[model samples]
Target: MLSKLLIGVGAAALCATATISLADTSDKRIALSNNYAGNSWRQAMLASWEKVTGAAVADGTVAEAPAFTTAENQVTEQAAQIQNMILEGYDAIVINAASPDALNGAVKQACDAGIVVVSFDGIVTEPCAYRIAVDFHAMGKVEVEYLATRLDGGDLLEIRGLAGVFVDDEISAGIHEGVAENPQFKIVGSVHGDWAQDVAQKAVAGILPSLPEISAVVTQGGDGYGAAQAFAAAGRPTPLIVMGNRYDEMLWWKEQKDANGYETMSVSIAPGVGTLAFWVAQMILDGKEVPQDLTVPFLTITQDTLEDSLAATQPGGVANVEYSLEDAMAVVSGG
Candidate 1:
């Protein structure tokens, strides 16, 4: 059941139509508040949120806003934004927490003020509200296991995301657990990519010479692109295996493979995550009871599964049975 719910939420993130009308203004106000807006994927998510949920807003509408991506990637301003929403008496609040524990106090305050609160992507500790998130642990383990089967015995390098972020921690934990079980694979070093492509690329460029024998590389987010660029620049064999998070990066990998005849994998799970986050907020706003933790099932796309473009166009970016939004509302309302 938890899996099903996560799937439902994931589907919402991947496919959303942006024709919602905001003609209605009532007491049932909702806020779509986000932590960071700097990345391409995050921008895409904001667009989807406005598009898919806009249609039903004639009687009530959600106010969309964002917090800047600070030098520390902090959400202090975002927390204050929620406090303002509470003072304004918004009916519900939907958030993507920048830090796991830091948002707990603010979330508790919003909940105390009678606002329905929920989180997405990164969730807070003790879970003051429900969450919609991808299974980072599962994602890390699955990707690493794939790399292990392909590389046999070799040196590996990892480019990770924002330091101390829960998603980063979850993926790292999963990778460590998977790697610990395998003796042939040794992780030589890891540099914080901060989920940025350029940061990852720079990190890899500096580390490549020092670890020339590296055979496999796995990255948490945008840094995957950097790893590929480093391999290209160094004129080295593409890591026997590599995996990354966004679909566009997969497209780049496909291009690299086609042009150079080098194989790579893209295990993208971002689009569906937006869907999951949005629905989780909706469910909570409607007063539905959701599981404390849920993992959206994903696929590790290689050359073979790369041609399913049309199917990939569907909601969640992974094919699945379509569920009606009415059902979600029904579940939330306990009708």
Candidate 2:
């Protein structure tokens, strides 16, 4: 009777362990490579990711597998890291590729090695895996339309992000589409800000004296703040219409509004990209089918839309609306 009881107890224990293992695949680890942590949006995104997945890391309780931040914004570094992940036999890889095409070879290598790769935020035009992104073209066109309504026929200074990026290219195309529809709006000067605050400030400062006819500035969110600083320094009396930048720097925008009397607009792209990346990772781990393209909704936030806009910013400062693993799974399955 005692021997029979011992055997039964051992069998139950083994079954429970196996069931727990099957429920959460946290043991299936993944690596995340962000394009760079060079801005407020990226920082906010990193914090959000930690908040969502930190508990699992702390308790070593991955319902799926391990996920970690492996590299930041270097194309070469990303390639090396992906190679390492392949060697380590990770189940999935989530990357925010710095360049649209530069990471293609590395991505192909990952696929060749039978590892799952999903790129988000920025895309690799070459199809090695899944892609999740914001509709940058729509974002740009929407922003330009807003600017067009604010101005009739004024000289506009445009601030651009990194050159040759898909986001930049697509957004530029959208802006052109909007601008072409309104011929009265003239582009006085267009400068590359590289999406950096200091870079934008310097770029706009240099152009201000030469193109003083600037009626309003159209630019990336980061460049929007820089344009405001430039306008203040140059004593330019023009309003700025921009995409999401200075997300946590609302005080700065309010101060600028009071002092410079210029208005700004932005879309929360970071959270969208983060949530998408997490979903792609989940799909890869589940051995599920992933769509070639996944686009998240982008919201425009202005002083008028402040209340609605603030509602979307996650409590942890994440850019997108908060969602769970289950929600992400739903999206993956549906897509």
Candidate 3:
């Protein structure tokens, strides 16, 4: 009787161990759904996602992380792609939405199907989905405020971002707020850079001939370098250009500061914020509690920190950094 009882206990212990092992080794399939792939920032964001998800695959934390990009900036197409992901049975989906409100229904469908959904950068308005974003309004206010300190009220040219994007609109509104408060600073004109270098250069080049003498240029990211290039090509002294955090822009600004004491500042949404969303999804899969909304602060690169930013950047890439899983958890837990 004693021997039989011992065998029963041992068998129960073995079953418990096997169950735990199976749970540990279970695969989590993740998918990244991006809206547009036109700009370097978007490319860098994709790179960040690839790096993190690749590591997860190696460690058996992720089963798959297939990335998909839309050729055009259309919400309907993105929604359809997401619906396909639902049918394909993705464990999690990270999105850089094309529109804030347009993807709500699809995102809701994903949530209903028991898939974890997280949005960043160009975020979605689906309340059921998790969001990790920087405060763009604050970013805009700060960018304009930094330029205001130097210009002390002058003809500031505003280079807006992609039309109809929530981030672009919020930042523009914040800039207008800053301009309104600082009565000395006046926005003489505005143009759409579409947050691309060549595009911004062409747009600025076209408008420079018609606009009055500008004292400063306030630009969204991916356009600062091009705007400077346009001014240089036009044989005009470049105004105090507040830049976004791009590697090429940082390199240019650093060289200018070294050569001519050209002073400026840069701030933008970090490409690695995508990685933050990746880790957030991983945590949720691991049965860790995370918030519905989380905020990662924007990376602010000034002259003093430019060298460090450059050193941290990958060669031929933008200034980017990824947060570790522990670091992400800290942000989520308010730690």
lDDT values, one for every candidate: 0.63, 0.66, 0.85
Q: What lDDT does model 2 reach?
A: 0.66
How do the predictions measure up, each by TM-score? 0.69, 0.70, 0.77
Q: What is the Cα-based TM-score of model 2?
A: 0.70
Per-candidate clashes come to 9, 13, 1
- Best-performing candidate as measured by lDDT: 3
For candidate 3, lDDT tens digit of each residue in 112-211? Answer: 7778899988888899999987888988899888976677678988999999987799889989998998889898889999988899999999999887
Query: Candidate 2's error at 263, in angstroms?
Result: 4.4
Alpha-carbon runs more than 4 Å astray in model 3: 1-27, 35-39, 69-84, 87-89, 148-153, 163-166, 202-214, 233-236, 311-317, 333-335
Candidate 1 vs candidate 2: which has greater TM-score? 2
